[model samples]
Target: MTPKQIERIQNKIKKIKRALAADKKHWGGYYHDGQGLRYLPPQFYLEINDYSGAMRYFNWFNKNFEEDSGYPIFLFEWTITLFKKKKVKEAEKKALETFCSNTYLIDVFLGKDMLEFNKNESSNWEYSSLIEHLIYSKDQEELSDFYIWLENFTTSQTFYDFANKFIEIEKAINDEPMGKKRSQLFDEKLKLLESIK
Candidate 1:
């Protein structure tokens, strides 16, 4: 999620519900009113393990916000949730949706496909989310080849700008003292980075 999307999700949990209920008449399309609001319910529901609820929000999101800038984040999160629920086929479909929305994601999530990361953009938080998805799913594809390809692909100066920022974000996440989860994310990212050869 982008900073704006993350802020909205935090706001949804903190303030949006009360604002929406207290002023329903004034809140028409409230969830869809903002740049990233449409992603809130689906991600929140997924966080709580409400797959059906997540699916409902995902359905609505797909119908209404397919072209929204944040749609790829929603699709990626939804794909991870489906994979967590053992819905592999559905997850793959969602993964394809994510790829179609932004092929940079293909570089992050489907690295086994060996596609070039031609875009000049750097590491999106969505990339970390995709890494988490792969970790949680126990994907068996060898990481070394992907890392090699990614290293070479990311060598361009423009991509290096992105990669440097990615390292910063990765370090911050890894250094958070939250517990085993953050540690695992750190470990997984490190393992991949270390595999470049």
Candidate 2:
């Protein structure tokens, strides 16, 4: 796009940021009052190659919006922002969290068969499902570098080991009767998730 068009978009994003800030101030810095627009600033900042701006908005949103149900697309963007900020370990951890929340995404991105994976074991949230992946998949070209890093990470031994262990625990949790064994499995799963870093 031309410089004029880029500047226009930047101005629009700034206007949106101002509006969201006003809403937050009106709400006394409690819940985010940006309607569904809360995820846009970070994403728009990322698209404009303003990694610091994206990270700042991400940090603010995450800190203040305790009731926000996360969007997988935004989480994916957050991972990219973290990487761009040179926070490699945080980015890796966020990638795992993003994958766990939306297991079909990377698989679909890799052109793998989704049916092979246990969809029943995946997140029940619509935003973290195959449909969500499809909705945001068009943005992949804009995020090609991050996707390349993700592709390599997902193919690594570390990722495979973690995924295998997670799947095993999920399967065990599904099969086990509701009692101490199942509870123990849940604890194991939590520990495994926390061990991603």
Candidate 3:
């Protein structure tokens, strides 16, 4: 990619990150991706402990779809797992159809297939690296936004106190075997509710 292309993709990433921050309150679930299924976001597939964080991902997804990069479908375990097996089966079918689509992303580096990392593999933290890479090379506004959110959101002593539980919850979800992704999401929602209460 040329300097201009790099800059454009970088800028799109920023918009996505910002949008993700904006809607971090939504629980995970199966969402639409305008055209059949080729353009789907990662939220449609992963289980999330934090509703707000998942919402943020969705928010970014909507923004990205609008940007014509591609639409993202979420596999929000917390929200979608509640459906009956029949429903899940149907949704999964549609999701797979979208997943198999050819309208891949044209971003800075990896396209929409960034979610290809194996969740069960021991070294599958590669997707997180994408986040790190984008954030690591972020320009002024993104860095500032991240700092503000991190400092302002996580600096509370109460939040720090709950960090261990959060970590545990996250680990449980990330370490799950197939068909059990939503197991830890409830614990997280309960924790968030407790915090709010």
Candidate 4:
């Protein structure tokens, strides 16, 4: 929260935003073919209790990228920001928008239904925020609906294609630590897949 910390975080955010701008095609989805933009920089802001900084990242991103292609997780953060600011109606709207965007992939990844399948290569902010919502939700219907979609999608060929690529990529890695992590992740994904019902 010091001036130095703020500057460091701002610099990191600028660097990430520039990188993501250059690689616009790889934005969105559960996987990335390159280093991929992560929710980490913005997440770091949140960790430091810099809610305004986090909102700035989300707002800037939304302005620069298409809603569907921009990181869907940003909406979750936006929703959190809105809620914290006591803009309940706007927060609810953003929350619904977040849930509806990239339905299959986001739900599966954020719900942690097949988290290891993502190789921990992505952000968990969306999951964390959604869990927070679920913890206080007056209605459980949305949660059930989300799992229903996840269960169905996991059974589809689209999900298999995504998983297969992840498997293939991890299998080719020569790094021992990464390989071990991949193996553990693969196992965890399998268990999650089996237990999703």
Candidate 5:
């Protein structure tokens, strides 16, 4: 596009940021009470190649809503932003979080057959599921390097080990009775996630 067109898009993004900020202030909640609006600024900033701006909004959203679940696409973009900033470990952690959020995403990206998995069990259609990944999947040509890195990382033996352990833990969690043993399994799961290298 022409410079004028780019400028117009930038101005529109600025307006959107202002409007979202105003709405959040008026509503008096954490990003409109956990609505998807929180992803807008970062998404827009990334589109405009404003990495710092995108990172700032991503940091704010994560800091304020650490306990809340993140959208798969949001986490994926955040991983890209972090990787661009040379934050490799943080990017890997976010990638793992994204994978855990939707196990089918990497498989889909890699063109692996997913027919063996029970689609009904993973069809949330909103968060952390194959349907959500399909809904959010878009061509990100500018992020090719990030995709390459992700492909390599996800295919690594280390990742496979972690993934297998995570699945085992999930199975144990589901099978164990609702008691201290189950709680310990949950703790083990959390530790395993945090232990991602």
Candidate 6:
């Protein structure tokens, strides 16, 4: 999600939880009337205590509902983080090979998250959201090839800048640039090229 989308989610949560409304920026959320005025990031929710549940709600929103599957992809990373923390490995391979796979994802995410966007100008809303989702998927080496291809397909020109940001905000989710690991994305397809005994 772009910074604004993240803030919007935070504010949506604020609506469901009133105690959180006191601050304009409750826990990084932006709040105000429908007109969009009179807001604060006061430290009140910190004292109210309902904030934690609401924050968890935000986490849930990220996990279950999003413009795309980035939330679940992020959850996959987080789940991996937990496994690494707990030192568990029994289902690790299954999780990586099957659960967190493009094949496993619903068709919407099959190859849709690779579109590129403008580097300088504001982008169309539909294009921006789609492009943002693609950017988010580009974080992992597993998803890098797709993004690179998308970038090439679109070319690095802002005349057709899809997303509002050149940051490719999707890539921001990733700590490192993804590499060209085509085989990892396909085994049988590669095997089809090999000789059989």
For each candidate in turn, the TM-score is: 0.41, 0.77, 0.28, 0.39, 0.76, 0.20
Query: Model 4 clash pairs?
Result: none
Ranking by TM-score: 2, 5, 1, 4, 3, 6
Candidate 2 TM-score, true structure as reference: 0.77
What tens digits encode model 4's per-residue C-alpha lDDT throughout 13-80?
A: 77886676656655553234265465556555654557777776766656654323335555555665
- Model 4 TM-score, all chains together: 0.39
- Cα displacement (angstroms), candidate 5, residue 17, comes to 2.9
User: lDDT tens string, model 5, 1-197?
Assistant: 57786687678777776776787788785356444566656566666677787788787776777776676767777887898888988888888877766666766665565423222232252233444434223246766677788878888887788777877777777678789998998899888877753
lDDT per residue for candidate 6 within 37-72, as digits (tens), equals 111211122223234443444355444334333333
Q: Compared with the true structure, what per-residue lDDT tens digits does model 3 show for residues 38-138? A: 22323322222233544455455445454332322222221222122224333333332222221111121122234332232233222344233231211
Which is the leading candidate under TM-score? 2
| TM-score (C-alpha) between model 6 and the true structure | 0.20
The regions of model 6 sitting more than 4 angstroms off are: 1-9, 16-135, 139-197
Give residue 70's error in model 5 in angstroms.
Answer: 1.3
Worst 10 residues of 6 by lDDT: 37-46
lDDT of 1 by residue, 42-142 (tens): 65664444567666655765665555545566666776666656676666555545554455554555444434333323346434344443332114343
> Which 10-residue window of candidate 3 scores lowest in summed lDDT?
102-111
TM-score of 1: 0.41
> How many Å off is the CA of 174 in candidate 1?
36
Cα lDDT for residue 117, model 3?
A: 26
Q: What is the lDDT of candidate 6?
A: 0.34
* Residue-level lDDT for 86 in candidate 6: 39
The lDDT ranking, best first, is: 2, 5, 1, 4, 3, 6
